[model samples]
Target chain A: MTVSIKITSPLTNADVEKLRAGDKVLITGVLYTARDAAHKRLIELLDKEGIALSAGKLPFDIKGQIIYYVGPTPAKPGQVIGSAGPTTSGRMDAYSPRLLDLGLKGMIGKGARSKDVLEAMKRNKAVYFAAVGGAAALIARAIKKAEVIAYEDLGPEAIRRLEVENFPAIVVNDAVGGDLFVQGVEKYRGTGND
Target chain B: MRKVSVKDITAKVKELCIAAACHLEPDAAAAIRVASEKEASPLGREVLAQIIKNFEIADAENVPMCQDTGISVFFVEAGRGVELDGSLEDAINEGVRQGYKDGYLRKSVCDPLKRTNTGDNTPAIIHTRMVEGDKVKIKFAPKGAGSENMSRLKMLKPSEGVPGIKGFVVEAVREAGGNPCPPIIVGVGIGGDFEQSAILAKKALLRPVGGKNLDGDVAGLEEELLKTINGLGIGPMGFGGTVTALAVHIETYPCHIASLPVAVNIQCHADRHKEAVI
Candidate 1:
């Protein structure tokens, strides 16, 4: 069954585990944005273990949060953000397992995740959600507010905190190991059955 | 010399860029239309419909077809008598910069090392060929990163032959799964060395869907590959279905006897490409 939720500022890890593939979600909450470069930094901090976060070496706490895989276009005047959409998820495959291990929960992006990341999601009771790729302008409207919370040097791929209301996404994976992409494909595969 | 100024070249290149990004080619458009009907799976059909809608919104609103907007790639064929009266490379680069800016498309080009976004979308990957006649034909394809990232090239043994090529492409697509966006068009480049094979694979993407290969042998091979790729059950968006691949285009050239190079460049349903001969 399709499900949508309203999330307030700062999502909890528990809330993320409730998502599963094949379930449509309308998320209303504050989610962080980070792409390849930011993800690299995030994992790098994680690699440092407790040493980084203990000394305030890191930028933000990833526990019980959502990160969007996006690199938006430059915004015009009077705009908080530009056309923001998900980048490919596989590019972040190497870093995702590390993030998942660090208490990260929900992720918003397009495309499929790597097997390693999926395994991580299953193990940690996390979820990966997909917003429609390329529907940037439409997706951007879902953002009620936007601000660069970290990684400003990374430009458009910087880490951002986005307050979104009714942002649409479909859960691509769930804690129980159900994969929406795989199941969706199987359900719609043109064999003898439709 | 034609004495084309930077402004003229930039304008032309920009035209090509915007045209390629905003509009879907006829064959690709047609393929999506067909997929909507032939797709037995309701979900597959729904995805195809959304793709078609994407094309419409992209064109109507003058927005980019996809947010990735893609790396600027120009396939140029110059006429025998034509001469560049400006900085050809600079003009092309300027065109890309302006096109992305004016079109509101994303700037995807970056320093591979620094990983810094170029901001202007410069340094386009330009391929030039001198051919007969007094015209410059430019084909611009704003290849999205998703599909481009999924591309692969394999150097197989000559003895492996047709089965090897088929196997490699199928494996590549299966591995790609939903990453490249399925209901894709597969471009195959065969018979060239490593670099040449990669270029050939990209060049093959210029061919119209359902277009026959120039050589009958290659055409037959393409058909076989198409059948096999569809059989992978990748379906639309990797959802299992019969129409995983809309078309498989093959381009072949003579190569050294010792090498069998095959490259596969996959294009998603949003195949934004255009060509102009001037």
Candidate 2:
């Protein structure tokens, strides 16, 4: 059975703990957008900051925040944002573990994550959600506002903060190591009886 | 001989860019609708429903169906007797630049290593073939990287044959899982040289969804592959259902006796493409 729930971001450990693979969610509140390019920059900034406290710092506070993997098309006049859908998540696997360790709680993107990412999520009590791939126009409707916060020169790959309402996604991975992709495929395998 | 203006070609290409971005081709839309009806999983059904609604919103609002407006790839059939005043390639690039800018489409092209945006999605991948008529026909397929990245090609030993080809195709989809965004359209190219095989695979996707191949034997193979793929339960977005692929299109050419080349070009459900003739 599938259950639908509403989640407001800057998510809590408790909030993510309740999510499980197969649950449908409507994520509201503020979500940050970044794709492969932005993620690489973020990781680099963090590394440069080093263990020793320096004047250098991350551009934005990532703790408890949810990052959406996306690089939307430019908006037309009178539109808040253009078609904004999730990109594939696997490409960010190399940088995800570090972000999760920084207290990032959730990720919204399509596709499976690497083993390292799943392990990191398990350790950090993070969750992974999948917005519909290629359903950008419908997904953009949920975003009420958009503003670039960093890496403005990256064009579409720039990091933007979005205020979203009722943004639909399904929980593909949960803190406890649940993965919907594996479960779903196993359940439906050979059901076609070919 | 018919005279075709480069400006006219540019205009047509511009119109096609926007059209392909905003509209989900009718055949693909129909396949999704049918898949939704046949989907057994409640979650899979819901995903398909959302896809249908997404296209509806895209059409009504004049927004791109997906953010990745994609790499502009054009297949041009040039009439041998037709005369053009300007370079065909430059006109195509100009068309892409104007279309992407005017249409507010994402400019995804970059210098791979440097990762600098081209800003105007220019220099489209154009494949030209000389045909027997005086009409120039163009087909534009805006291919998103998500599916394109998952596509595969292999040099198979002739002894591997049909069974080998079948296994390779299925494994590619299985490995792709949800990344390519199933219910996909699989285009198979068999028996060409390395580069030719890859191009053949992509070209096969130009065929209308749900249409059968003209060759009966090849058509039969398409059906068999389709059934086997759906059986893997990749489903819509890999959430699991009975409709992993809407169609399997195969294009074959004669090859050297010792070598067999195969390529699989997977296209997501969006399948954005359009065509025009001048």
Candidate 3:
């Protein structure tokens, strides 16, 4: 049985907390973007001794938000961005727990999560979603706007904010501690459900 | 006595780079189609077919096949008799700059310490060798990050032999699991020291999928390794299916009698690469 989910625009913390594993999401919302370098910088700033992103003082509030881990190629003339698709999320594992704690609701990327990340999602009531890793052109259709938010020095890997509608993804992990990769593998392995 | 201009080199490299990024090499595309047909698992077959469709759409729309357009790596064979009007290094860098720019490919390189993007995608990793001909040959492999992250090299005692080499390669890919993207192409570099082995392994990716290893004994090992890898059931994206690996390519060189060095360079299904001889 397949479960489906609808993610509305201008999402709030409440909307994100409701996602479950195996749910197919038709996400219509605004999102933020950050790849490896941006995530590193964001975390470093938070780690600084005297610096802080207190609830109201941070650059942006992440509660009920979705983050896409992507570093798209530069777009051609008349295009907004090029090859805008999800990158491997595992590389962001170190910084994710902190973001989750700070009210991150959902993550969109390809591949599996680290053990610590999975644990953080369970504790924080966030969800993990997967976009087709290489389907950049297809995914780009969902984006209505994309602009850099911070860390411009990182080029394509820099952090940005995106507005999207009907972005497609499948929930790979949920707040209840279910894991799609693990379950998906086990289901077909013995039964030869090929 | 043959003269080559930096502009010519740059233009050629730039053109090849974009071509490779936008289009799947014919052989690789063919291999994916064949794999899709032969895959036993319905899920695996579907995954394989989607990958093929991805290549088609990417080519049709002139977009990259995957978001991680990868670091710019080049293997060049230059002729001793040829002269470049400007620094060959400059020409190569200029080409990468233009390629990434004009191709709309990702500029992935960064300052290792600062972790800041170079913006122009300059200072590409280049390996050059002088060959007998007057024409220069170039191979471009825009390798993605996921596959590069899973690459590994191990130095073993010569006594460890074939079985040892096989075990290490399989272990590295298994540990990588879904991370590298499945139906991987495993390039095994045996012999040579650490760096040399890695270079050889990367070079092995230039071979067409299903191409036989030159060494008879190593070729046998290649077949055996391919079989063992498929048995892991990691499948496409490690989602669990019948075919985990599409092919394993092995290259070897004579090493010190006491040393056996092995390096594995894993390539995901995207496998975007190209070659040119001029």
Candidate 4:
């Protein structure tokens, strides 16, 4: 069974724990956007923290925050953002576990995640949600405000803080090891009624 | 000999690029509408409805339907009797650079190893063919990485034949699951040498979505593959319902006696492409 839920960020352990795979969620809050390049730089920054070389701090604190994996097109005049859709999440699997361990509560992207990331999500009480992969124009409508916060040199891959309202997503992985992709494929397999 | 100036080509390419980004092809839009009505899962139907709405919004707002406007790929057929005013390749690349810049399309091309953005989305992948006429026809396809990454090519034993081909195609989609995005269009290229087969598969995608191949037997095979794929229950967005694939397009050519090459090019629902004649 599926339920519709509205969530506001920054999320909490209790909020993520309440979600189940297959839940339809409307997220209204701030979402941080970053893609592969930004993720790599972020991890490098985290690594530098131990060296004491004066790299300073992360652009934004990630604890209990959601990061959307996206590299949007340039916005036109009068637009808050351009067509902004989720990129494939599997590309970020290498860095996800570390971010989740650092108190990142949620991730928004399309496609599957690695097992290691899923396990980390379970351990951290975090959740993985999927925004529609190719519905960029429609998704951009939900983003009320957008501004670059870090890695401005990375072009579209730069991290931006987005103020969104009623942004839609589906919970694909929950804290309890529930996976919508596996269950959904199994349930409808061989049912060629169409 | 007839001459087509580089300026004319640039203008046409720019127009096609913007049009492709903003508009969902009529055939693709209609197919999604039909899929929504036939979808068995409530979630699947809803996803399809949202896709339809996205198309409507993209067209109205003049925004790209998806953020990854993709690497520009062109298929050009030039007439033997036509003379070019300038280097055809440079003109196409310049057109792509301008189109991406002016249209607000994303520049996705990068150095695979060095990982540097080209910024202008230049040096498009251009394939050219010579024909008898005096006019040139150009087809532009902006292929996103999500679906392009999922594409597969297999060199099968000639003995494996049709059943083997079918199995390979089915398995690829099943493994792809939701990554390529559900309700995809599968392009299959059969026979030909390895590189030729891959190009054939991509060219097959230019065929109208849901349109039948000219050959009856091939069309029948396409139908069979479509039914088998949808039966896997991948559903829309892999959310678990009906309508996994909207169409399967196959293009075939003669090949070596011992080798059978097959390539699958998967396309997401956005299906951004356009054509022009000069």
Candidate 5:
């Protein structure tokens, strides 16, 4: 039962700095959902739009906002949304640097990060958080509302805007080059199973 | 001769798709529980706890446990004594269409090159074998790609032998790390041709979690690999702990004397699969 640091979205540089790898946080605010497919589309959208950050071509403002790497199941009758969970982040590595350049503050996903993505995060002062991989049913409880905002033609991979409440996540990689995945492994390695 | 209606097959498969999607089987659930108590990392323990609760929540709510319900895969044992009145494959695909739509499971199948979604999660990947029985046995495994994409198959030289198989399987899991979602179940297939070996690896996953191969040597390899994989400290969701893989299952077949084929199919903790005799 870890006491999580409660925070809201549109996190500032101070908010990102106060966090360290492995610290649990509960986020209550708006989050945008995107996966590899949506990410590719976004980068293409940006490249097409040129140097203007908010060239009016973008779907939503990327500045200081977090993009959760997820493609969730469909909602049933009387349900806000279906099983929503974090996907592997490595899949989004190729396009992340471009997003980071635009002041994207945080990312939520599972698995390890690529070196390029890490370097970009460091340069842009962003953070990476991880939600439990298979914990979709439980994770969905924290999401109060979800609506597709872009790429609806992508089906489940469509980008969506979500209003979340007390969403649980663990900071995996911080702007200071601290990574929970690396640190956790080093601590337990060669300790052997008991 | 027994007449097996495709309708019954369709009905059964429909039910199986929903069951496999929403529920976590007993073995998987129990393995996570065992890991939770022994998990060396507090964060790993916490993750394991969430997995346990996630399954329970899905079961109670009758919703899918994970967003990616997976590509519907089936292993069918069609009895020699039974005669099918219609196309078995068509029935299976129809079931998938209904199951995915009605179950609210995500339609994840897509064209490989064009990258266009099929909209309905069909046509299923079916492996049918003729067996000596009056009833048909269907086993359903909706494979999530996070783990499926990480699965690998290799053609080894005959001289590489058991050591080669062991090394490849362990290396695959290491490379996959948390991508497939640990603590994972590692399924190893050996001795068959390239495609057959891949199927053997996947079929191995349909076995009861922690179940050993009947071959004594194969079973030994499974135990050894299980221990080595757990030692990697990938832990639950790769946050690092002692329990990386819950089990390692191996299935083998006789292959060419000149070549040794091995496949490793990694399965996440969700491990949604079930079987029925109709």
Candidate 6:
């Protein structure tokens, strides 16, 4: 079995440089939750703020942070949160580049990314990780705490701040443009019916 | 003749909805464990392991296996002799409403254009068929959008034949790549009108995890497609590995000479489904 590397979020370039696609990692620190609706709103906020000729400020700082593309269920009583898992990331491709350019260091989600978003990640030294899709209840356990930071009216689609511990994920895209999905598939492809 | 109560149907659907969320159907669960053992890529194996572990945790804690508890979908086998005291449709919708509420499952249904939350997760997509038996069968499958969004439909010319069907199915999985979540179940519907094709594709998903089409030729195709998909190496969660799809299920119906309609419905590793007969 390949061993997992332990890493903290708010990752620096040096940390990102050492990572590669297919490397298992356990993340510990703060992760911001946002899915389709939240991503759209964040981009609109950026645009409006930019138009005002003010510091293109956001509800939270985008620098050195990771945005998790997830819209979790409402928590049960006496629970921190409900089954919280990553939604497909491809849906957010349209809005992701803008955030990545603003110094966002990483993202956690499932599925492949669009070309533009991926190029943006490589250009900006950001990384993409894949959490097991539909593995929400298990993933939620790593989230020690969660609270809505913005866009509360969107409910599950709202943006929230999560404090996590030993959050498991695998690096799918790295800063240097290594893609596990591509390489892995090519490796086994046409090694026919094996 | 069996007299199935409308309230009973509502009650059963309610529990099935909740159980479907919290539990990963046993066959799918077992398939993942089997896949984990044979996944060629270490990363792929890791993903399968996590999927299995997630279901176990969800089962024990009675929490949803995934947050996107899915858009509630049902297939009902209404017996010809059974008399319903009330509206069967209303009972099913009410059951979804109460289940999503009481179970704390996500209310994902929304108005397409208006994008408004239905609030109660109502108006389930139900397909009912009357059968000869006196017993009513309710099969519930909560479909997560992650996989459903990848589904596709096509009307092939009669010339496309079996090769055409196989080619289309393989290409659909290829294009779908890791998005539908690898280690997926490919449900292919052939030989029906456009809408019926789509429905058959979905109904194909309700088959037991490792089950095959009874027709010998169709069953042969299922095996071949499984090998080819696994060869794609989309692996588990599309991180690349040897096991891209757990199974490919094909359901076919007779169609017009000039037209062949095909639809592909992809189910992610979660594969949440349940059924009960009354």
Q: Best by lDDT, which number? A: 2
TM-score of each: 0.90, 0.98, 0.92, 0.97, 0.98, 0.97
- Considering the two chains of model 1, state its CAPRI-style docking category: acceptable
lDDT at residue A57 of model 4 (Cα atoms):
68
Q: Tens digits of per-residue lDDT for model 3 on B185-210?
A: 89989998879899989989889987
Instruction: Report iRMS values in order.
Output: 3.8, 1.7, 3.5, 1.6, 1.3, 1.5
> Per-residue CA lDDT of candidate 1, range B1-71, in tens?
44345577678888888777667677888987987788776656656665777677666755566667788
Off by over 4 Å in 1: A1-14, A45-61, A76-81, A184-194, B1-3
lDDT of 3 by residue, A1-194 (tens): 24357777455657656776666688886888987777877777787733455534345677767889988878778877777778888999998998888878889887889989989888877888887666677677788888987777677867788888888777788888887777766654433211
Summing lDDT over every window of 10 consecutive residues in candidate 3 chain B, give the lowest-scoring window: B41-50
lDDT comparison, 2 vs 4, better candidate? 2
In order, how many clashes per candidate? Answer: 3, 0, 1, 0, 0, 0
Query: Which residue ranges in model 5 land beyond 4 Å of their true spot?
Result: A52-56
lDDT of 6 by residue, A98-125 (tens): 8888889999998899999999999999
A8-78, model 4: which lDDT tens digit per residue?
Answer: 98999889989999999999999999999999998898887864433236788889999999999999999
Per-residue lDDT over A1-194 for candidate 2, one digit per residue giving the tens place of the 0 to 100 score? 46679999989999999999999999999999999999899888877778552323667788889999999999999999999988999999999998888888999999999999999999999999999999999999999999999999999999999999999999999999889999999989887422
| Rank ordering of all candidates by lDDT, starting from the highest | 2, 4, 5, 6, 3, 1
lDDT of 2: 0.92
Stretches of candidate 2 exceeding 4 Å from the true structure:
A1-3, A52-56
Mark the 10 consecutive residues where model 6 chain A has the least summed lDDT. Answer: A48-57
Model 6 regions more than 4 Å off: A51-56, A192-194
Q: Name the runs in model 3 displaced over 4 angstroms.
A: A1-5, A9-20, A48-53, A187-194, B40-46
Which is the leading candidate under DockQ? 5
lDDT of 2 by residue, B1-278 (tens): 78999999999999999999998889999989988888888999999999999999998888999999999999999999899999999998999999999999999999889988888997799999999989989999999999999999999999999999999999999999999888899999998799999999999999999788899999999999999999998889988778899999999999999999999999999999999999
At residue A146, what lDDT does model 1 achieve? 90
